[model samples]
Target: MNPIFKNILAVIVGLFVGSVVNMAIILISSTVIPPPDGADVTTMEGLKASMHLFETKHFIFPFLAHALGTFTGAQATALIAANHKTKLALVIGAFFLLGGIVNVFTLPSHIWYNVTDLVFAYLPMAYLGGKLIKKKKS
Candidate 1:
């Protein structure tokens, strides 16, 4: 298998896996809390009511999911030719984890802002996942 192509596949796999991980985390977390008793969850106002709950419990996990996804994606990519899969995965994981930490800082103080941030965050992550997948083999 071509190294580059393997990486590409890894990224695709990462994107799918990462998206699923993220959504699962979101759904499970949201359910445990259940929308604020009677508070609207649609409007920014409603979202704010839930922000503390979300940030408190699952924010880091999302980051972890992103990081792990990235690491996995990169490893998948490197697998095409690289022998040191573990090391490369660690490197990619570190890169991704750092990115996620930075992302946390970008979050608006406003809870409603996340909805806007959400779209911005996910796809780029997929792209980044691809980048990891396509990274040069160690």
Candidate 2:
């Protein structure tokens, strides 16, 4: 198999799996911690408008979702890539980071939440994921 093709496929699968994990966490979180009463969380616009109604606790699941999703994705990429495993993992992290940045700009989250999510969620998790894979391989 072509190394380039394998790397590309790894990235695609990693991103897909990561996104699925992210959505699953969000779905499970909604069940575990229902949104504030009368808060319409069905749409981004609604959620953004209702951000003021949420407490700090409401952000925990989202942070976990982002971090875990990134970690899973990076790990998968590192595991599958034929070469430059860490670089591939970091690429996945960059992708998620871009999404996080866009979410921050589009949504009306608290400054602290935004900072924490953006700083701690994506890249760090991805790096950890890559390291975990490397350690396991060694």
Candidate 3:
């Protein structure tokens, strides 16, 4: 297979895998930690309307979902990419980061949650994923 094609495929796979993981976590989050009363988490409008009712506990799963999804996606990319493994991983991170930035504009999350999620979730996890592959190769 061509390296360029493989790399493109890697990115696509990473994005799909990350999205699946993210949605999976999100789907189960409310079951694990119930939302505030009347909080409809089913739609964008519902989430936006209920944002003010959310507590710190409600933020935990979202953070985990973002971090773990990015980490897993980056790792998958690094594993499959023909070359530039770390760079590809960072690409996945950048994609997720962009989404996070979009969420910041669209959602009404708490400042602390925004800061923490933006600072710690995407790139760091992706870097760690790339590093994990590198270490394994050594």
Candidate 4:
């Protein structure tokens, strides 16, 4: 198989896996935290409207969803890439970071939550994932 094709496939698979992980966590989160009463969390507008009602504890699942999803995606990319493992992982991170940025703009949240999620979630987790792959290979 061509290395380029393999790399592309790795990226696709990584993104898919990461997105699945993210959605899974988000789905489970509703069960665990249960959104505020009458929050109508099914739509972006509804969620944004309900954001003010959320407590500090409600943010934890989202952070975990983002971080763990990025980590799992980066690790998958690193393991599957033919070369430039770290670069591939970073690419995944950047993709997720862009999504996070979009999320911030689209859905208003607490300033602290926005800052923490933006700063700590994507790149750091991706780097850790790549490092884990490297360590395992070594």
| RMSD to true structure for each model, in Å | 8.0, 0.8, 0.8, 0.8
Clashes of each: 1, 0, 0, 0
Worst 10 residues of 3 by lDDT: 129-138
Ranked by lDDT from best down, the candidates are 3, 2, 4, 1
Name the weakest run of 10 consecutive residues (lDDT summed) in model 2. Answer: 30-39
Write one digit per residue (lDDT tens) for candidate 3, span 1-138: 999999999999999998899989988998999999999888999999999999999999999999999999999999899999999999999999999999999998999999999989999999999889867876
Candidate 2 local lDDT, 47-121, one digit each (tens): 988999998888989999999999999999999999888889999999999999999889988999999999999
lDDT per model vs. reference:
0.48, 0.92, 0.94, 0.92
Alpha carbon RMSD to native, model 2: 0.8
| Candidate 4 lDDT score relative to the true structure | 0.92
Per-residue alpha-carbon lDDT of candidate 1 for residues 37-95, written as tens digits (9 for 90 to 100): 55455566666555554543345444445544554455453454234444444444454
lDDT of 4 at 31: 93
- Cα lDDT of model 1 overall? 0.48
Off by over 4 Å in 1: 42-55, 58-138
Write out the backbone clash pairs for model 2: none
Candidate no. 3 TM-score: 0.97
Error of 4 at 111 (Å): 1.0
Candidate 3 regions with alpha-carbon error over 4 angstroms: none
